[model samples]
Target: MHRFANPGRFLRLAGAVLPWLWATALAVTAWGTAWALLYAPADWQQGETVRIMYVHVPMAWLAMGGYLGLGILSVMSLIWRHPLADLAARELAPVGAAVTALCLATGSLWGKPMWGTWWVWDARLTSVLVLFFLWLGHAALVRAFDETERGARAGAILALVGLVNLPVVKFSVDWWNTLHQPASVTRLDAPGMHVDMLYPLLVCAIGFSLLFGAIVLARTRSAVMERRIRALEMARARRADRPLAAAPATLAGD
Candidate 1:
């Protein structure tokens, strides 16, 4: 991990891997959508409306997963000073936030027909909302300082601090009397979902994860290039300010 901290190495590696990652993501996403929407049997309760879960559930899963990834990257940045770790965390913020927002929007859409309301202050919902805000906060904090390094450090600390919400969002249904249902997908006693439905959901989840990775890597690479350009510009500015040597002819004349 530390060796890969070198930007050149990182970029080369990413360039090699990104093509495969994107291809896999697109393939899986397409197959998953078809399987879930066309072949998977409808829920006994929600019927056709249950198809929304195909998108909603996976995005919700990725929302939390992306944050956890960012938090872990933050820890790595602070502890090991990995050059790209802060960039990774900073880049992950908007992607995670977008996914979380989608999760909420889709949830609300699902909720309207199922729960009879567009919004609720229930445990799972509220914690997920907090997760979105945390992402926003992380992005804002990282850019709040003139010193980019300091801002990155401050943002990393804030992200680690917000790690508490991840578990809360995960177990909210179990820990509280909420409107949300308990884990159907993740259960000790066999998945509450049939294999037919579960496979497509899993495909979609994996696809989303890969897509998130591709986006984050692309963003981080752009950030690193920007940083490099800024450093070069600063160096050039300093060089321009230096006094030039007087000509020998002028010295002789004086």
Candidate 2:
């Protein structure tokens, strides 16, 4: 981890891994989509509409997973003062927000038919909505201050504060009365679904996870380079602004 904390080392490692990550993400997602849409049978109740779960579930999982990732990165940045960690956190916010939006949109599309409404204010739904707002707020706060460090500190605090709701979102159906369904795919004992459906679901989940990893890696690399360029430009500007001292006698003569 310390080795990766060094920008030079991280850049080297990223350069080596980027190609494979992109390739694997593309291949896995293609197979996963084919398996989920073509091979998996329609649900008895929801019929073909249940097929939406393949995309919806993975997006929901990634939305939560992305926020958790940001929280961890925020902690690392605040405690260790790792610039790279801050950069990673900043870079990941938009991606997480996008995933969260996808989850909500797809959930609505799936709900209109079954739930008889485009939206609901159930515990799980409300909590996840709050999560999405938190992501947007944190991203905004990160850029609000003129000082970058100040902005990062504010963002970190907000991230940690919002994290308190994650567990509640995870167990909302069990902890309180809610319209949202309880854990179906992941249970204390075993998953609820049969292998016929579970395998493709898992494949889609893996593909989504891989896609997230690749995107984050690429975004983080861009952030690092942008920071480096900013630093260099600032240094050059400062040097240009400084007045030249009187040269040494020999140099002045030359």
Candidate 3:
């Protein structure tokens, strides 16, 4: 892990893994989408409306999971001072935010028919909304300062503070009287969702997770390359300025 910490080494590793990640993400997501929409049996109660779970559930999972990853990155940045963690977190924010937004949108769509409303202030929904806002806040805060280091530090602090919301989001359905259903796939004894729908939903989740990883990894690679290019350009400019600065001294010596 220490050896791989070098930017050059990480870039090489990402270069190799990216091609496979991209291929697998595309293939799996496409298959999962098809399976969910075209083959999976519709719900007994909600019928076609239940199909939204294929996307919604996975988005929910990713939103929470990705924030956990962000929290880890924040720790790395603030504690260990991991060189790449800040950049990785920066790259991860928009994607995480997008997935959370999708989760909210799909949940609303699913709720419309069942609850007869497009929006509600239920505990589960409200916590997830806060999660969404936290993601947005981190993203915007990280770019707010001219100095990237300052921005990263601020973002890291914010992420750590926002970590408190995760537990609230997870347990809201259980702890409160919410319209949202209790744990289905993650129940202690057994999942409440039928096996028929469960399998396809799991596939969609895996695909989304893979796609999320691929996107973040690709973005981090680009950021590293751009930073390297800027360093080289600055070095070149400094070298070019040296001769101009020395010209008067050279003339006086002559």
Candidate 2 vs candidate 3, lDDT winner:
3
Any runs in candidate 1 off by more than 4 Å, and if so which? Answer: 240-254
Model 2 TM-score (2 dp): 0.94
User: Which candidate's TM-score is highest?
Assistant: 3
37: Cα error in model 2, Å? 1.0
Query: Any residue pairs clashing in model 1, and if so which?
Result: none
lDDT, candidates in the order shown: 0.90, 0.90, 0.94
lDDT per residue (tens digit) for residues 112-221 in model 3: 99999999999999999999999999999999999998999999999999999999999999899999998899998999988889999999999999999999999999
Q: What's the alpha carbon RMSD for model 1? A: 2.2
Cα lDDT tens digits for candidate 1, 118-236 = 99999999999999999999999988999878988999999999999999999999999999989998898899888888998899888788888888888888888888899899999
Report clash pairs, candidate 2.
none
Better of 1 and 3 by TM-score: 3
Badly placed stretches (over 4 Å) of model 3 are 252-254
What's the CA error at residue 114 for candidate 3, in Å? 1.0
For all candidates, what are the clash counts?
0, 0, 0
TM-scores for every predicted model = 0.93, 0.94, 0.98
